[model samples]
Target: MYELTVVVTKVLGTCSSEVPMKPGDYLTVRNGALRIPEGGHICLYALQSLMPVLTTKERRIGEKHSDDWVWRVHHVQCPDPEGRVIFHIVRSGEKAEMPPYTPSEPCPQPQTDPSLADLRVIVEEVRGKCTSGMQPGDGFLLKSGRLYIPAGRHFCLYALQATLPLLPAKQRAPLDGDWLARDNHIICPDPAGNVVLRIERV
Candidate 1:
C-alpha cells in the first residue's frame, strides 16, 4: 500500500497553515460529521488502500465535501477493518535518522544449520531506544515505528507478516529470521518511516 503525507493545519485570524500533531490528537471531517478515530487519528492512506468500502467516504469528505472544511472534533463510530486504527507520525529529521551500519560489507547471511540453536531476534534499539519491550511469546506487536524482535525470541515467518499489513508483496517471504534485512538492516513497512527492526544472533 502507498502512504499519503498529511500535515495538520491551523488558522489564526486571517492566516491558515499546517501544524504539528502528536499521536494522541484526534482528527475529524465534515464539520465533525465523521470522527476518523477516537484516540488515534486514522491513517488516510491505510483507510483508502486497505478498506475499499471506506474510500468513498474519505474521498468525499476530504476532497469533495466542502472547501470551507471548518471541522470541529466530535465523537463518532470509527470504522476499524480488523482492529483499532493507529497512526504513527514521524518528523522529517527522525525519518532521516537511520541506524549506523557498515557501508563496505554486505549483510550477514541467514542461519541455515538446523543443529545450531535457533536465534531469537529480539527488539533491540527501536528508534535508538527501547520503549515497552515486547516479550518473545507476546507474538507480534504491530505498532508502526516501535521495533520488535531482539530478546532472542523465536517467531514464525508467517507471524511476522501478520504484524505488517503494508509490507510489499515482493518483500513477503515464507522463511524465518530477518527476511526483511538488507544492507545490514531489517526494515519494516511503516507509514512514517522504513523502521529498522533489530536483528542479532543469539
Candidate 2:
C-alpha cells in the first residue's frame, strides 16, 4: 500500500493517495498515513476476518473531512466491477503484503462429494473444489480467497438432515461403490465438513 503525506500547499478535502484502490483490498489507518497492502486486489465484497463474521465492508469516503487525523477511513474502493472511473491518486512504488485476517477457528479437513464424481470428470473437478471449500457455515481456504460459510440460523447447512429426503434423483446415495450403507455405518461428510456422521437409517 502507498502512503500519502498531508500538505499545506493544497486544501485537503478528501485527500487520497496515488495508489488506485480496489475492493477486498485493505488498508490500515496509521499515524502519518494509510498502509495499503500490495497485491491486494479488491473484490466486490470484503474479506472475512476472525472477528466481525457478518459485517459488510465499506468503500465510500467519509461523510465529511476534519482536521483531526485521529478519525479516518481505512478506505476500500469496492466499485461496481463493470463500471469505470472510481478515484484518483498520486503515485508511489513502495508496497508490501498486509497481515492476514486471523481465523476464528481452524478450517475443517478436506472433504469430497462422491455424487459429484458420477457424471463428468469436469463435474468431479468442480465438486472437489466445493469439498475442501467452506461449507454453508464454515470457512477455509478456497484458492486465493478465504471462503466463510455465513454464520446464521438462516444458512442452509443449518438444516442438512432436512434436505436429504429431498435429495435429487442423481444423488440419493453414495455415488461410487455401495461401500456406504444406510443401515450399516460408514463415514460420510456433510457438505460443509462441520459435521461427519456414522449415519444409520434407524
Candidate 3:
C-alpha cells in the first residue's frame, strides 16, 4: 500500500473527513490500516504512485484493450514511522461509508439533530461523482464545514441518497449523542497528546 499525504479537498473535494491530516473536507483519515473494498471502491486505491490517470474508456486503444492504467482508492493504513501501507484504511467506496467498523448496535441519541436536520450530506458517488455543497462538484457540506461523510460510508450514502434518497419525507434513523459537527476548537482531552491543533476553526 502506498502512503501519500494528500489534501482532502484534492481527493474528496470538501466533504471533510472526521479524522485529521487528510487535507480533504469530509471524514478524517484515521491513521491505521485499511483496504480497497470493491469495484465501487475502485478509485480509492487508484491514486497510487506512478499510476496512470486514465479513465476506463480512455485506455481502449482498440477492441483488444492494449493498456489499462487504473487507480482505485485503497484502504491503506495511516502510514507508519517508515511511511508504509501496513494496515487496513478501509476503501469501502460506494458499497458503504463505514465498513470494517460496522456499528454493531444502532447509532447511539437525543440523536443530535433529528433526521440530521443541521447536517448536509456531501456527495459520495461510486464512480467518483461529486455531490452537493461546499464546492461545485466537490461533494457536500454541513454548516461551516463541521461534520462530513467518511469515504467508507460513501457506498451506503450513494445507495441511500441516489437509489433510496434520504429526503425529508423518507429520512432514516440517526445515531444519538455522537454528532458530527465542525468543532472549531479541539480541546485537549489529555494534557499529553502529541497534537498540534491549537487554534479553533482554521
Among the numbered candidates, top lDDT falls to: 1
Which lDDT tens digits does candidate 1 get at residues 1-202? 1122222221112211011122233322221122223223323233332332222223324443345332221112223333333333222222422222211221134423323322223333334322223332333221222222323333322223333443332123334555444422354333232334443333
lDDT of 3 at 90: 27
Evaluate model 1: give its lDDT: 0.29
lDDT tens digits, residue span 104-155, model 3: 1222334444543333443222233222111222232232212233344321
- Residue 58 accuracy (lDDT) in model 3: 21
**TM-scores of all predicted structures:** 0.20, 0.16, 0.19
lDDT of 2 by residue, 13-62 (tens): 33221222222233332221122233332211222110121111112234
Q: Which candidate is the best by TM-score?
A: 1
What does each candidate score in C-alpha RMSD?
Answer: 18.4, 19.2, 17.6
Q: Which regions of candidate 2 are displaced past 4 Å? A: 1-67, 78-139, 153-202
The per-model lDDT (C-alpha) reads 0.29, 0.25, 0.25
Q: Give the range where candidate 2 is weakest over 10 consecutive residues by summed lDDT.
A: 117-126
Candidate 1, residue 107: the lDDT equals: 15
